[model samples]
Target chain A: MKREDLQLLQKREWCKGCGICVAFCPTKVLIIDTDDKVTIANEDACIKCRQCEQRCPDYAIFLEEASDV
Target chain B: MRSSQLVEKYFRTKNLPHIWCPGCSLGIATRSLVVAIDELGLDKNKTVIVSGIGCSSRAVGYLDFNTIHTTHGRALAFATGVKLANPELHVIVISGDGDASAIGGNHLIHAARRNIDLTLLIFNNNIYGMTGGQFSPTTPHAALGTTAPFGVVEQPFDLVKLAEGAGATYVARGTAFHVNPLVKYYKNAIEHKGFSMVETICICPTYYGRQNKSGTAVQMMHWLKDSFVLNTAYDKMPEEKRQGKHVYGEFVKKDLPEYVEEYVGIIERLKGEEDA
Candidate 1:
């Protein structure tokens, strides 16, 4: 399976509008939205680093391998 | 010769095409460590590598040494046990900032405090690179991360000083751009008698570089070259000019009884008591 098949999503309500994910992302995949929520702006660029998943204080983000779905 | 060449020599086939990103520094750090081991002429059978969860932890799987890819942030603790059980074995711990400092902070301190005969190489990329770009404990204040949208508000930890304060006999810091020095530091740490640590400030091109707009791997290398000052190089510069940049090379080295040696002493004393 292609590695990019992994998917990352943010729970907008749980997001504190913190841009920690944006700053830590090596691929610039996530971006801060107008509503102060984090969104996947460049999903294709993600290397599934999972830095955001572990560092998020609110646990607002989740990652799932595409094969699992 | 480039250290990466040595890594290719012993790399496992099953794990071909490592999981790290193209410009990720973990691979470079891993290569440097492996090459250092080979250069030191260390017996693979006598060497044991332990690692905690993270992108850097995957090094255990790629190497041919006795390896344990343990749970997140517990590599040092396991390495401590391994060394105490078999003092003849050379133990090495490969970890990332989140795995080494954040979750494994306590183990790190105690291992250094006890002066275990183990080498710890921390891949400090500032941000957590594996779980998406998130602010790690090492992330600088006002830095952007997944959790810190505006900026990281918390102060980052100085891993080298922490290890020194925790009683490590040797400590140093290097970046991927300085591969030769990094390999040298790793070799020194491995040869040291007591707990030795090298904090490698690597680049998380996929996470950290992208967020910081550091361009690409080449750009990150340029930044690293510009940010770090070798001790010898720094000594030539004005003190004021050294501010805010990492001082590379050996920071601390001293003689101290390693944990296994002290433990062996205890065992001997107990035997004497039993005889009495």
Candidate 2:
């Protein structure tokens, strides 16, 4: 059975690479790539609280819920 | 912390021990607002406190009045709607600098221009405290933030001036250190007939103060007490003496047709036509 929480990923092109989401996430689920685009490196640890989604300056990342998986 | 006090009565027992760090001025500002509300003897049932997302936005959660903690930077817009729907309701918007003047700047100006009957308590701690110490519109030039480690190149918005220019009927400024004056100004704003604003300068010791080497909360409070000159007293001081200091006091106050009242008039006129 898939875990109830889903791993989230980002669309690199959409990310201006602002690190606001990275700073805001209490769970530390997001990381900035070398190109300044944010990447969801650890999806399993994500609480899916949408802090990144709400704070992302570029709207680059989208959370895929566990139910979708 | 009198139980009979309006501010004390609305204290959230469940959220006891607030998350704000030591020396944060938001708690002081919140208490001043509540005290002002209580002193005015405003009907609790007709009071609505609205807020946008930020560390200070947590004020809505703690207040016992009708509260709506809306999306980031949208508290003014939401407060405008609440006041319009029920003209008798006393609506107040409480938010941080970023929430009020950065992303939510348009709403702030428009609300003032419309002369909406609402009180806006802008907690200007300079940096964006909630999402880390990021530079906000109110961040002083050369101040360090997570985004501007090298130093901020941009000039900060003077919110009281902006509100006064936008046509707010009553405009004033106060700091966390001056609690009694702050509360008194807040009460005046609440009683004012049109859009009234009180820009409360708060300390963010965890972020802005620490990064800027401004010392602890007490030190910041001392700085605020030292920095401001009351307008009533300032007018009597020499112009050269006032150059580097910020003057705080009521800046502008004049009655104008409120947005909701005009809107109601339009609705009534339209309804009359329909009946005719």
Candidate 3:
């Protein structure tokens, strides 16, 4: 499946703004905004590597319920 | 499966987001653990999680399992009793560096010597995080801590070697940066019978980082990536090139008589004698 096909979700309140996800994102798809929360800066560029999801220390960013496809 | 699904299934949702600092690697290590449990398809109802006092020990409070938040450095003692009472249940102990080595040091060695059927995961962040970043037994030599302002002069304990010397049936080390291998090690450690220990190297960016000028949280993560090498590669690297590099991998795996089974066997034998 394409990277953009996966629904990405982020819990802003849970984010502590560590930027681990932002730093580990291979495609530069995330950024810590002014509020110090992770936000999708370039969703279309995402490669679906899931590094951001895996590396996120706070569980702030993740893909929607993965299907068995 | 997706992380959200794992969280929904394995975690106490209301207790999150955890209180760990923004750059702390405890969450990552914790996630890998849940993933291992999920992949193994272990029965949540039949599993028990135990922990002692420390930053890493707080993990028990978040996990959705039969859990015990025990006294500092005594998690192994409580877990031993729990396992002996019900050997059918899977017992996993989570401990911090100071909790496992300094205060609970004797318990750790004795537990390993007994070869009890329990899994111990030590979150070795090299500092006493909960107590404000004091130097821990596993803290690297010459590293600075609140307790070691001028850097530590004493040699740090090599946890893998310690466990091996104590007679652990299964021993391995993994770091927060290498999630996949860590998950694999956790899986193996949990599945192995007799005393099993996994020393998970993690980053305590808030305390360990700030005190040592280790740069930002992101930079610390990179340092973990660059400095740590798998045991296999570490062996082949030149001695000079290996300086300052950390090694992690399965150090040992061997089966021995598990304590509970032996104790039970003795009981059964005595009962047979009485009947005769």
Candidate 4:
């Protein structure tokens, strides 16, 4: 997702596409693509709840605080 | 070379690409422990990780803390000594079902009975992963393992009940799919003053999964999502409806005088009497 707003730092290599983050997201911000990799579907709809960051099994998702530049 | 900032800080990045097979839930379990420690803001210098010989015990090498990789079934003994020698240290034990319940079961019970100040995180994968998929003490009845090709006939030990019966001040259970809840349990366990035990229902995708046909790692994760029921929710359901459901929740939490604290008190009092 875009860093100007609420950004998510993802180390995709660690990701096993467990789909826990995609399902746990409130705003439906992520999706497991056809290749079984997570993709940001709606960046602006993201609420930065940190649910995904907390629940991901592989520690693939990292939520960065929104920086006002 | 570390890509993740959190990993760089807490884990040995040089040990990147851990030995655990892909889709193994151990990483998630270890992550919860790290997250709990971070949330608690525990001083790394004063923290110690004691582990036994098993796949779950591999966490000691990657964790950036005072760690002891002890022999089979001896992690609890080593951790007890480490805690008694330095009461200031936060001793954490991470072990598998076989290492903790099968071989080290006595140490576990006595430690909890003593109400020692230590957090024991038992990774209950059901089967012994590193030991060629033998049925462990926590393995579900009739579950398939290498040693039990026709399925296990013996019943599994309920860890939460055992810990509570043995006098642990804090006891909780959580699954790998419920990482947030696992982190909360771990955080609470770490903060607990007396002996604390958190049984993590982890997924062993390599040996157990392949042998039992439990599905791929992702599917196993989804199975956990579908199966786990919190104790609160279970209480709300009808008794018959709760059958076959694995309940995960904080079963007990009480403030008890920790063994370490009490032992130190006795030492000071005896020393004073001798001086007098």
Q: Candidate 2 local accuracy as lDDT?
A: 0.80
- Candidate 1 chain B — worst ten consecutive residues by lDDT sum? B1-10
Q: Point to the candidate with the largest DockQ.
A: 3
> Model 2 clash pairs?
none
How large is the interface RMSD of candidate 3?
Answer: 4.0
Residues B1-276 of candidate 1 have per-residue lDDT tens digits of: 111233335666346456676556676677678768889999989999999999889888988889999999999999988998888999999999999999999999999999889999999999888899999999989989988889999999999989999999999998876777888999999999999999998887779878878776656766787889997888899879988777788899999877788889999999999999
Show model 4 residue runs off by greater than 4 Å.
A1-4, A15-52, A65-69
| Steric overlap count per candidate | 33, 0, 0, 0
Mark the 10 consecutive residues where model 2 chain B has the least summed lDDT: B1-10
How would you encode candidate 2's per-residue C-alpha lDDT over B1-276 as one tens digit per residue?
A: 112123237655445445676557686788678768878988879999999999999888877889999999999998988898899999999989999999999999999999999999999999999888999999999989999999999999999999989999999998876667888899999999889999998888889998999986657766887888898998999988888687788888898998888999999999999999
Judged by DockQ cut-offs, is candidate 3 incorrect, acceptable, medium or high?
medium
Of candidates 4 and 3, the better by TM-score = 3
Top model number, TM-score:
3
lDDT per residue as tens, model 2, A1-69? 243544465545545554656765768877878876677777667887755653332334555543432
Q: Scored by Cα lDDT, where does model 3 land?
A: 0.91
lDDT scores in order? 0.81, 0.80, 0.91, 0.86
- lDDT for position B13 in model 3: 78
Tell me the DockQ of each model, to 2 decimals. 0.02, 0.01, 0.51, 0.33
Q: Write the residue-wise lDDT of candidate 1 on A1-69 in tens digits.
A: 354665776555555554656766789898879987778889888888766654443335657653343
Full-model lDDT, candidate 4: 0.86
Docking class of 2: incorrect
Docking class of 1: incorrect
